[model samples]
Target: MSSYELALDRRAKEIEWENDTCDQYDYRIAAFCGLAAGVIDALFVGAPGQGALGRLTDKGADALVQKIAVMLWKGDKRSSAGGRPRRAPDTLERAISYLEQAFPVNYDARYAADLRDTGGALSSMAAKNHHLLSLAHSPDLIGLIFSILDQFTGGASFLYKGRVIRLIPVKDARGNKTAYMQGTTFSSKLFCGICNWLGHLASDLCGSSSTRREGKTGRGAGLPIPFYNLLLLMNFGNFDGASFAELAVKVFEEGYDLRHGAAMAVPVMVEECSIKLIWALKRRFYAGKDWSECIPSSKHADLRIMLLVGNAALCLVDAADAAIRAAVSGGSPLTFVLHLNLIAWARLITLIFKELRIRYGAGVDGAFAQYLAAAGLNDAYALRQYYERMNRLDATLEQKLTEFVRETEKEYERFINGVNQSLNPACGTPRQRQEASVAFARRHGAAPERIMETPEQLREWLGGADRQKKR
Candidate 1:
């Protein structure tokens, strides 16, 4: 079979269904199944905090998975109302019951606690249970869901009105793929919004935030309402429409279709680090000592916590970077730009780490050693030395980072120019303006000196002639 045919075959097998002539309903069900299967697999393989069975038994599981089932159930109900047959109401309940029985947990107890804690209102459950919410909506978990969707949907790229929209896979400063997961591609507006949201999360955590300029809640601002609602259900995942339109034009002009999605994963990584750093700082701050003040009577306890968390965050970044490098070994311009941008972010965090360390006395090393001991690193001395070396910021490195920042800014400007040109072809180019001026002069039957380059120039000439007439 051809590759496309093979893909379809594989998808059918994975989804455990084969409908050669499927309607929109079947497609929707397939999408839901792909997502649910991904979530289930992730749970089995160890989702956020809980083990496989624990996920089904906990309030988090009930809140996330059951709600998903409820949504599908609602969709089925609507389909039935529209004259199509619907699945039984008990379908979702049965699934939940089976999961509970499989786990052999006291469902009544879990459900009672869930009701008591949530007050029987699903509306505020997410806010009240942040740990569960974060786990359910983690970037990795969402990314896994995306992977599964790719299989069920025939490709990662989606078809809307016969056009295939895909998120352009990211590349780094060294011309390497930022993420090389299967089916990754260029960005659509929705994908861009996701990236922007991730960026917002990172920026918010680190006390630095880019101006939104365009008023938009990170939720499915421009997308259709139903899809936006789905995103909310996922709880896993931006700006103005005009800015996005410009970005789309620019990306197209640059021979790339990559959009906001390309920009998102890096920020998520950066923000993950910033979150830990912020937690440590806030803990210290509450203890009656600011970074500017003395290291409080608590000594450098907060600093140690910050280091441990920061180190863990950095380790994740390293792993992500390695994966990116592996995907983009030979390098491309896109990857090079992405690499430079990501490196600047990573370095900024490192600088923050150093600043914290300098504020605390050398005795802070004792806390760091404890972290090393807890981590079970045999070479405490070597690990400390390595961390210090990595975290240290020197004059030359700082200068280079500044240069990278400037270059990245220029590249963005260039992309924006492309967007402008693409969006308004006639008014977009200087050459087009010149041609337009010539055409206008021809239409007016202008004499040799009749035409002026601009309104200001014409005004200047008219003023000169009036003065001559007075003379």
Candidate 2:
């Protein structure tokens, strides 16, 4: 077979594999896994202030904040007896205070009046929800960029009331409003800005320094949920009397911050791991499949569908639990909405869109587009190279196959003309013409015995002429 024929056969098999749907049993197992995850979320990851998992994550965040603070505390001097720093910020409060002094930003404004004084327009901004309003306080790429920009420009950037507001030349601790870092080269200043950004984030991860100092036991204002600051830009929806941006701020104020975000991820991780594990186990033990075949990935149609089913089930259960709790607690819409696991729903929505695209999109072309879109091409350069090579190979095979077909047709035409010329009454007898045709068949790469066979046999011989020419 030619390379083109082999490629077509492989593509057919791939399409068949992709189209393979899961059976009822597989879907049932997926639902069971999802229900189990939902149970875990309901029992352990309810509202941020109430759930056990939320408290655990809060403690973890606090520990992380303290570790970062200690690392950044350059004031502690090394002891003569040992290399360890002596009298390091001994408590979370002390550590936070050290970081506050070490990395001060100009944009620590925590009230509407503060923004007004800075000539900014974020009136709804306050200490309780300032972190959510401030884009630089987020823990994402946008946040990083804004953080660096604010550091360099001595300003703050905030998204509030469906608009982006920038306040420039804000005063720092020294009461001097300067744009660039003093007494440092460009590179040093840039490095310092990054360190300051990270250090400030650490300081605010648990709560403000003053809040810690006051010994507040309540969930004080911390950093916004990872990427949740972006949600403040989604100012379209108006539930009750507030837009989505206001709702996002309200959510952050009500303890749906980064620590609570961590807690929400638990059920999402559980559902995903459970689905993959059970799928692998069933393939290995029940179906007696090879270890390689037992690897559960989204590439498999059945596994993808199973994941979709599982996430759907998890979201369903989580929503139901939230609804029931809300009903019991005087039926507040915000309360029910806050209880719902946003992470699980996000996962389910992603799976649904993926499944739809796979099923209804342009097959291999669509899959390739999706791969390119999702893959970090800068990091996955090897994978990008592999795809380029495959594309080149396919083009070469197609070109060769086309040339072979055209050449075969021309050769067959020439052979028929030669045979007809030999069969002319003026040239030879019947047996002589038949001998001439037999010689033509042998010249075209067929065995002499096949000369007298059917036309199919003769065409098959002609097809091999290209392969023989290559040799």
Candidate 3:
């Protein structure tokens, strides 16, 4: 029985044991009601003290427990009263709670499961299948999830050296949970939030890229706040079912618009298939513990690489995102760069925020402001050289690559140092940077087999492709 149930039983007994039946008020109302809580309190919190109903038959036990739970629920609701002030739980917290309820895992259950296909298949789908709204501010919802996620503090342990992998369950998806240990480091969590926010925004069906511009100003001005606002919204809800595939793709195709000065490129954001592919991979993997084992370390390493490349790709993606705005208006480099750079800057904030959390802890004082503590980009020049070399080695890669250099600042310096060391001692080619770039490109799904061999030759293919699109 829950604490509420124990209280109910005691209250009932107090009413039954009433000596003064002649007068109902004389029986003591407080005595009657307080008994209910006394009886059930031990049941929920597991402190101590049992009520008369403790030894009841199983059926009666069930009934009494349910009744007490109902009363407690009612009391809890009443206690909350008309929207008083309180902090809200976040999506991740709620997700953790869902996992707890579904798995009902405890510290003793600190075990690992295969991560692959673990998402929907294993889940009973009851508690773990709710939509975790990201930025749209569901305070109560957020608060609830956060409360749930709290169950993992010092409770579970994983085999990752001394590291603990707290798996977060998928709310909307049926039978799975994510395997990645929640990187509680400020930087990791912050980046995760950014990803989550991006998801929330993208899932919003009500808006499109057009929201960035909506007004009666010049040819294209206002930056359709509504559209972007809705864009942010759609990203939170699950777009997993087959129908969303067509809808997302169609909408993306319609909204994709990027420009360079006046030179607008048609479909720069790559197909929705790409983003969908990421989610699909997530869906296919992010289950339990086994997923980490199933995916090769090389693939995992490559994703780390992709995260880097993707950030680098963002320079272009940022430009592409800007293109969406540009598509609405005629175009200008200033507006394009302004919007692009602004998002890039947001990415920078996210990056810096993430690195701080990783190096220090998120709980450090004023975590959000930690970027001020980060060293200035002393390695930007080296990174610039790296990029120039990489691009020169394969111009197509110039278009395809994206990197998150902020986090790589130290690494870039280290790489430069190593290169300098290897060169003077034995003597080597300056082209090694270009050679390294080629190797890095090959690591990704780069099938530069024919594409790199002849960019000029592909002009015919590109021409044909454009003609087909136009038709």
Residues 417-453, candidate 3, lDDT per residue (tens digit)?
5555434544355456445544545544567763333
Candidate 2 C-alpha lDDT tens digits along 70-186: 765554454535333356777878777777766677777777565435554776677888888887888765577678777777778887655567876345644565543533755
Residue runs of model 3 more than 4 Å from their true location after superposition: 1-302, 316-334, 337-352, 363-367, 370-471
The TM-score of predicted model 3 comes to 0.19
Clashing pairs in 2: none
Superposing all C-alpha atoms, what RMSD in Å does each candidate have to the true structure?
28.9, 22.3, 34.3
What lDDT does the true structure give each of the candidates?
Answer: 0.35, 0.76, 0.32
Best by TM-score: 2
Off by over 4 Å in 1: 1-63, 75-78, 81-88, 91-301, 304-471
lDDT score of residue 426 within candidate 3: 43
- Give TM-scores for every candidate, taking all chains together and pairing residue i with residue i: 0.20, 0.69, 0.19
Error of 3 at 405 (Å): 53
Count the clashes in each prediction: 23, 0, 64
Model with the higher lDDT, candidate 1 or 3: 1
Please report how far candidate 3 places residue 82 from its true position, in Å: 28
